[model samples]
Target: MTSVRQGGTGPRLIVHLPCAWDTSATYGPGDTVFGLREGEKCILEVAGVNNGRVFIDDVEVSQGEHGRYEWTAAFFAGRVQIVVTSSDASEAEYFASVGPSSEKVADEQFNAMVGEIQKFRASLLLGSSSAALAFDDSPGRNKLDSLVGLARLRLYAPGFLREVWEICRAPHRSLLQAERRVSLARVKRLHPLALREPLIAAAVAGQTSESPSLELLHVATSTAVQTFDTPSNRALKALVTRLAAQVSTLLDTVVQGGLGGELQEEESRRPRREHFLRHLLKETKVLLTREPFCSVSRLETSAASLTQISAQPAYSRAYRHGTRALLRGVEGARTLDHLHVSPTWGVYETWCFVHILSKLAERLDHFGWKAIRHGVVSAAESYELELSSGIRIEAHFQANFTAGAPPAKRVGWSLSRFRIPDIVIVVQSAARLDFLVLDAKYRSKRDNVLEAMESAHIYHDSLRVRQQKPNFSVLLLPAEADVPHLDADSFLFEHEVGTISQFSPGEPGVERCVDLIADWAMRDAP
Candidate 1:
């Protein structure tokens, strides 16, 4: 058995799973260890496999003694946990390790990033849930008391809870309409011929010879009716009922864990948040057992028919007014593949930082959508912002300002090229545009710090506009770095270099930095 110590030197991440049937020494049940990096290698080792199996991210790797499993960390980043389960043993030990690699973001920053992204994602899931509801007032009711975390369970577990609810409540009206089919037979009574075909067929069949007045002349007909028990509706009923049972079971797990109440109680002072959930569950059971059935797909087959039945209005309610369409814009979201997993923490942190900065800063007016870059030659995305004081800020991300045309056509294009800043704040005030470039370095390693600062300098020197110096060229890193002089100066070409932590929004250092940046933007006002 390899005895790996905590916090080993070099770029390494190690987790020691203590020998216990229930290992909660390092992490609680379902809790994950942080500081995972991409493009590295990971190894998992089992000390003893008495009757145990080891799993990583829910995928079984190996079992038995001397079992060593290895995988590349390129595709997997974010939280990693080790689980060892033994049927015939009381305790089992496991150890997982990752090879040295570039330092990823701090744990606090990563958690904050995940939380921020989860906020919007949660709202989308809740909206989808509301759409699945059958009542007219459900949107308003859910707005007052929907638990998004519970709603997100639909993402992790693939099922049709919403579709079941939709069908159970309304039960496609078209399918409910009863149609009668008439057949001819030799029988006991004669009936008025709304349709003469059946009577004529019975007469021609020579039933009259059996008993002249009462046999062939008297046509008997059997009526076959269409109902929910028919094959089409029955198939739909089977599917929805099965899914409802599965979803209800998963919901029970969430309820027992008490996840929904905690999240909902935090949002509202109302004590009945859990009450609403109980009611929903009860309704789900009743709907699943109802005799009448309907197909959700058939309801959505036409735009006009659905509207006539008031079903289309339900989806419209899912979209929040005056906001970007979250759930509606994405295709195949019914299966919820989009919301199933968390994005990489590095990417998420950058997005959260920009979001917080854009929202909190009083000077800035507007910010655009995040543009994801796919290749080196791809054009960088710039968020457009307009200040109340007639200043326009174009915030570029990973842009290479030095790779463009020559100095003859541009101003101060001196450096050779190839510099990509994490965020480049280009302030356009009056006739010139000055830069306040930033690089969001999540890792606290000294070498990475130097590289970030060096890149910031390249951007400042290469992107000069006719003697107009940069307001500030800063490195935005995690708070753990404690880089010196983060809030010292912001004057153009005067102490313009510094560091600002991404986690330092309300902190004195970040407040001071934003104040200085805002003050500098207004300093040259005409």
Candidate 2:
């Protein structure tokens, strides 16, 4: 590990990962430490600063003996930023990349997983053409309330801004023709009608029409001038201006409201967010000063003008996608507010559920199962697929379940208390209803995998469908190395609890898991 000094003064920051093979590394601002495994704990010590505070991913770390601060990497693979602030106001920033410990899984593979999750979320919303999925009104359990604002700034704004720029660069120009008095020499194309007026004026002025002083002679010439003040251009300009203002207001609300502390931590423990906002504001102002935007006479965004904009191919893509992103706001189902700081476990869980549900839907289709209702579950952060074969698959995002709740709200009731499994598959036949509960555990370690299996056992024992235990309960874990302890066949036959490891997108085992569930559903079908 290479040591980098911070400002050539102040304190020296040292990082120690007791779990890793190379246990120690020195880091400074803009430095990244690699080879750290996900779920591993690390220690940070700041030399030369006795009373300083340490923050990892914006959460302050508790000081231990000898002024060492510890933080555990999250279960998912991603990069986390750390900041150490001294009493003298000096700060040093560092980053750590957590990857899968297994040699079988490459670092790119884990990074690609995160990317795929993000893409999946965007596609989910984009694909829902007319689905009325509302934004989250309340703060999420993750406490990042203004996810819509963050999505506007982070995900959608860049592309939208690029499209706006493209429109500004070569905007749709409209030709304007006006009848005005101009010198005879200025008329490039001497129209006969223009000459008639000019000859009449020359005759009145007592001068020869042909050889009259061109400067002295005037003509009623019709001039065609290309201008950027078209209705389409005005509409585009209006949209950009309104979007910029709305984004500014949203940022202010997010920074000053509940998301203040969290966003501050995300912005490098400094005023980096302020700097970014300021840069955006400046860029927007500059964009407005450009040709089309500036030349637009009025910021009137009428329906007809907007329709005109959509008619042209050059402006349609930006207008359509940008308006959609703005109007849809933040999806409560896929909250990406904290993705920059840390890719939360909920994201991984949702990805696993979607993957399994998709594969299962494909298998069911092969068996001639047609979807009756396939869309987002109303008033909830989940997607449901109801097949013609009486099988309903639901992928929930942190939905709650309680024994006292209504039947429509509860996927399955807990005999003792409440249970909220990550994924649930309920198959209702004419005779009986069979349930398959799946809990996604983002752990790859042996101990963690075993601990997560307890959830499966608990769900299998407690959750009941029509006063009966689920036919099968499974734990979906990240890696396959440590889950050989729980045999799938015996657990399903005797205990009704099992584990499916390495159940990720594009994994070969995904098909097998989907097949197993499909087989059970087919067997129970009426």
Candidate 3:
């Protein structure tokens, strides 16, 4: 079991988790988990606001003193998955391993999520119309969400690999033509040398004959050459051959490595990639045959000519876009290690949630509400989405508590001057707007949850007076089952800030969140 030096004054709660749980094997007795004790003061080391969440017996425990709650189950049987994570389907990484210091992560779920996300991403890269809805189509907007990992940026990989396969699938071919050029030189054989009319007459008639011309034979000659044997074509051939070999090697690595066991299942499913590699290898072997006229000098000359030919506008333009994309795709093939080591995807979680929100918005088609504008507001740390009917949703990140004036609540200098709310979605109607201030607390300990509620309250009040619209708020905590709701309401009591405390922005949870927001937005709709 992994162990860190245990010397801290922060309150620590001893949670008795089951050994069968993923991370549970890292700590405690034979069947039970251990090290952390009940009613001991300790603190959970977290990197950022969205680092992790702690749950006891599937129910989330908020930040607080150890004495506040009794851990009677320390000696009993139970389960706990530490470091619960909610991530995008494409890039979900939950936990490491189970131990005294280790926590549980959702591996299977994450893999399934990734598979689904890749399918969608692939469709988008292929220019599918249905996939267009996943992105914001507003003018000057990025084709996809910016808050994504490196994997989604693989538009070039498929195309580049396919090009490689096509190149190797046959003997490389180039346009072959007999080119004729005029020359000025006297040669004994005039048949091969295209003779001018006067030179021909001079050659046909002896020098003593009348009308015999003595002009040096100016002639045009024609030569037949295979374009494929040209240095430019050879260079292209070399590049494709190298790429095919490298791709084959990489595919083997991916298939064999299990990507540290993260992608074991993926190895068997991608038969198409493997199949293409086989054909490419076979074709590359066939095309490597030497041409009859390819002497050392000719080959050297051809190689020298390649640089100039490839640099020309026609060839360069073709390779620039495709080659760069191919390189990026190749790099992406090695990203398995990065996904496993990093604990958090940071604000990408919020971005994933935004995607879910968009899906929910689209579901409102029966109501004649379509997403018209959804894009990142460059000036601020906020993203906005507008429906066809005039309803607008804007999510602000780490927003300050103010509309345009001084502090509304002078409870303390810290709470008064600025209140940090993780997410503040402003849903505006045609005539007016409303606010849903949600604190996306990764961990829902008593102290953290209370602080979030306080901030939500202050933000709701601060904006309510200035905007003069209904403002509701909620404490968004990552948990197993829905936790007991606390008595949190806005200062005006116009709306209640409840808990999406247990639900995450994964699948069903995101849908549930959408239902809640849609119901709230349509509550007073015309």
Per-residue lDDT tens digits for candidate 1, residues 245-296, read: 5445545544554433234423342222244345455654665466455223
* For model 3, the run of ten residues with the poorest summed lDDT: 124-133
CA deviation > 4 Å runs, candidate 2: 1-73, 78-98, 103-236, 256-271, 282-295, 300-344, 358-403, 407-419, 444-454, 461-469, 480-492, 498-516, 524-526
Residue 437 shift from truth in candidate 3, angstroms? 1.6
Candidate with best lDDT: 2
The lDDT of each candidate is: 0.43, 0.62, 0.40
The stretch of ten residues in a row with the least summed lDDT in candidate 2 is: 125-134
Which parts of model 1 have CA positions greater than 4 angstroms off?
A: 1-55, 58-185, 194-222, 225-352, 355-360, 363-385, 397-402, 406-420, 463-471, 480-496, 501-505
| Model 3 quality (TM-score) | 0.41
RMSD of each: 14.4, 9.6, 16.8
TM-score of each: 0.49, 0.56, 0.41
Per-residue C-alpha lDDT of model 2 across residues 346-373, encoded as one tens digit per residue: 4456667656655776887843323333
How many backbone clashes does every candidate have? 1, 0, 18
Error of 3 at 206 (Å): 2.4
Candidate that would win on TM-score: 2
